[model samples]
Target chain A: MTGFGHNSEDEAEGRIEALAEMMARLPGLGPRSARRAVLHMLQRRDLLMTPLADAMHDVAAAARECVQCGNLSTAETCAICREERRANGEICVVEDVASLWAMERAGAFRGRYHVLGGLLSALDNVGPDDLRIPRLRGRIADEGVREVILALPATVDGQTTAHYVADAVEGSATVSTLAQGVPVGGELDYLDDGTIGAALRARRSL
Target chain B: MTGFGHNSEDEAEGRIEALAEMMARLPGLGPRSARRAVLHMLQRRDLLMTPLADAMHDVAAAARECVQCGNLSTAETCAICREERRANGEICVVEDVASLWAMERAGAFRGRYHVLGGLLSALDNVGPDDLRIPRLRGRIADEGVREVILALPATVDGQTTAHYVADAVEGSATVSTLAQGVPVGGELDYLDDGTIGAALRARRSL
Candidate 1:
């Protein structure tokens, strides 16, 4: 954390360095790249920096996981689940909040979402209890949910979790999954609008 | 901004729309790839989001332009100019702060920097007064600067500005420039450390 090359005592260093440290930890950024990014943001403060900071502050203060579905929300339940228009006897299940957001971006699904938080990873010691399996079961009974659409990753853990969830909801509700031709190891969030649309339209029985 | 189709409150809409809007505005990101990046970031928020958000916030508050040199600084003068060791009778001149930082990252120069903010653009009606030209002349006389390095972009505007600065500092200091073959339209920030090093080593009379 202290190894970021340049150091200065300008009153801004503390805040800038803190930001750089956090950015350096991101997937594609290093100490050098983070420094560059920080500098760029400072240069464009009015158009980019201020708005971005406000958004971060708002989200940091208000963002909370939906109690029922694990999606990000300002309220206990995400807006998706709260909307009566979305509860057409269907639920689209995804592995993470990002995926749920992606499904929403496509604007094709008129259903609520159930965020699993993560897949059941045996290698990582994750299991059904570790995920939202119990809550999903509870929802099936409580909401009279007709269909459960699995929009998980194509990785082994994701597929395994999908199948496991399918088995759990076997007798209780109709279980389906976004179709293949989705790239292997790909998350639903990476798919294009067309591809996501195709997968959703061509969803088959699980 | 609102037309980008981002309705953060609407859980019924998909994330692709939100991603497209955000991506279109990024420096190197586009709408087509924004969706992919958003998905990638969400999939590994532990690996990406938390860090990215932190970086965004830190930079948002700390980054400010050096009042003296236009370099990204948390202070009045950038770290390079403030260091007594770097004030060793030399000032490397560059078009922008990004270039100056790029030089620092290479760790080759042992001198201070003078950022001109931008090149002279005739079509855009930019003039010598618009840049730090007068400041460079004043620094030479005030700081007893003996050598002036011109690490300018290879564009028409950049070359014009370099020559103009050279004329102004001709009698006061030994003027030089980074050798050609550094690539036209390529920013110093994008150059490899080795290339930058070689360019610095082989710098010629301007």
Candidate 2:
């Protein structure tokens, strides 16, 4: 341990450590997982890591926030915005890119999305002015007379933001919130008191 | 849903789908996690994705398997092989590069390592000639080696390979297998009978 050590010549060690550290910064990966991922990449250098590196580099350089709707795209305006048919009198608004992706995965929603980046959090000093509120107001006036679907979270801040949006688009378009009910696989037993009450109130006869 | 869609101009969608597909190929990632990761990368392009891309590119370009020992390194011959001090007349033989990394993590062994790439498996048609066995024998003769520590798995194939290595280096160097027993925190009740017997046989008195 004392005499025969690999302390002086640790260049490869440093590089590997650096890669792991950076990898740990990504979501859903911590220090140990990141190290594991890096080691895995190192092993599959020609197959996995090289192609992944190229893809990331290309996306990093080309990908940008769509100026019109705040969705991510390589071009100036996102494909959804570039398409004339998507402006069919409805705009589904979501809080983040992840939420947008989820909606896309479902594919039930036919309209395009306006990713708000984040919810308006007074606690975090996030206000309407800080978000794309003004852009929404502009889009409503310009994108033709239509319906606005506020697919925001059920938090206090979310509700507050929804009310603000409804008020902003008061005269231009109709505003609707997602129905309050138990999720598809959710049991009534697991529903919170407020959710149960809201569901009961919104219940309709078959 | 039927009438309004972005059908003709689908370039951006294609790119996003391609990125998600690639992300899914990495370990610990599936279709869902891949989509989430891609959206996150697009969101943090300037901060996370760009730097990660750069790091991956650099590592992909520079990283290589050490010719001498089969450990992952940036150079042709790894730093561990280059260091004269690490050549302590002993080589810790492991099954794969990951095992080599695990040994490095422990920092117990002061000597260098030899990654066998895999164990000798008769079922899988993996023989000594298929592995780095020849290279290992060559190193033992040339590197002035005195001991060969078989830090291989306790599987049937692992034991078979260990015996083969021991016989190969019988006259020239001492061969020692890693000690087998219940782990440090293991309880006798939880341990299997074989492990308990191993622990009993390996018991060291204070």
Candidate 3:
């Protein structure tokens, strides 16, 4: 008996391995899960793998950031930005497109959105210029936006970004943030100290 | 404020949403994680997304099962089957290419491998003919195989397939299975009853 041949790694196994490696780099996948995903895809080449590859290629080639608001788009403006009625004198600011999609999924906010691309991170050397902060300020005045809703995360960087944007657009529009409190359907005991405190402070009469 | 535009699901957002839906179907990923994966890819289009798409496409087009051993291959025979020295009268039979890759990673067994693709499952209606049992039998005699190692799982279906193959190649070659014992670095306290029982039953003198 002999070990795996030298060419074994450079053959078909190698191609599959390379694909798995790329998959492992994905946000929610690790080495074991990536291998499983690759094998699953290979097993259903016609049904799943081929379609997924084609979908990825299509998105990669066509998808672009919305030039106006930083949302994903195939053209200069995103679908939301292109919608006439979404321009309801309001713009919701978010850290990234994921947040914008989340807001859309909720179907609660009817106004347009502005994707910040990222928060102001001093440690990583990410500054206001790195994100779409300047464009957001421009849209406020140009679109006659009366209100700016900050739907950013509750992290320090998120707060820093919200304050900075609020100051930048001061007097231009009324700036507010998503309310901080225990999530709906959340238990009081499970809530963090900060959340419980915020919820108590912002308590309203029923 | 109005609900999302009727055409919101038909534009650029629709494309990204479709891609996310497809990605969510992959193993180990759900809706939220899939969205994160897509967003992460989109953020680094040049660094990750395009290359991953290209890799998947290449694998989809080229990958094929080895005609002789059932291992993944780009050509008629897998790298293992094409290697001359691997035909050393020993053949390790495994359930799928993942198992074959696992064996290769361990580098313990030096002989060639045979992939069964799946186990005999009465519920799933999988049988010997559905798998590569016939090929294993033919290889035993044709390759002058001395030992046929069954590297199958310990599940009922796995054992059934192992017994079926062992019976099929009884006279042609010697059949054996891997030792069942406490895994390396495993705690006996955390082991399941079946594993502990198997370990005790197969215990040997030090």
The collision pairs in model 2 are: none
User: For candidate 1, lDDT tens digit of each residue in A25-141?
Assistant: 544556876666666677677777666545444444444566778876655566777778887889899988768767877898998889888999878999888888889989988
RMSD of each: 8.7, 5.6, 5.0
Reference contacts reproduced by model 3: 0.62
lDDT, model 3: 0.87
**Which regions in candidate 3 have their CA more than 4 angstroms from the true location?**
A1-12, A188-191, B1-10
- Tens digits of per-residue lDDT, candidate 2, A1-206, equal 12222333558656777888988876667777777788788778788888888888887766667778888776677888887778888999898877877887788887877878888887999988888888987888788848999999999998988888889889888989899987899898888999989888999999
Sort order, TM-score high to low: 3, 2, 1
Query: lDDT, candidate 1, residue B3?
Result: 21
Candidate 2 CAPRI category: acceptable
- Alpha-carbon DockQ of candidate 1: 0.22
Instruction: Determine the TM-score of chain B of model 1.
Output: 0.75
Q: Who is ahead in DockQ, 1 or 2? A: 2
Q: What is the DockQ of each candidate?
A: 0.22, 0.28, 0.40
Q: Fnat for model 2?
A: 0.39
User: Considering every candidate listed, which one attains the maximal TM-score?
Assistant: 3
TM-score of chain A of each: 0.76, 0.90, 0.92
Write one digit per residue (lDDT tens) for candidate 3, span A102-198. 9998999989998888899898888988988888778988998999999999999999998999988898899999998889899998888999999
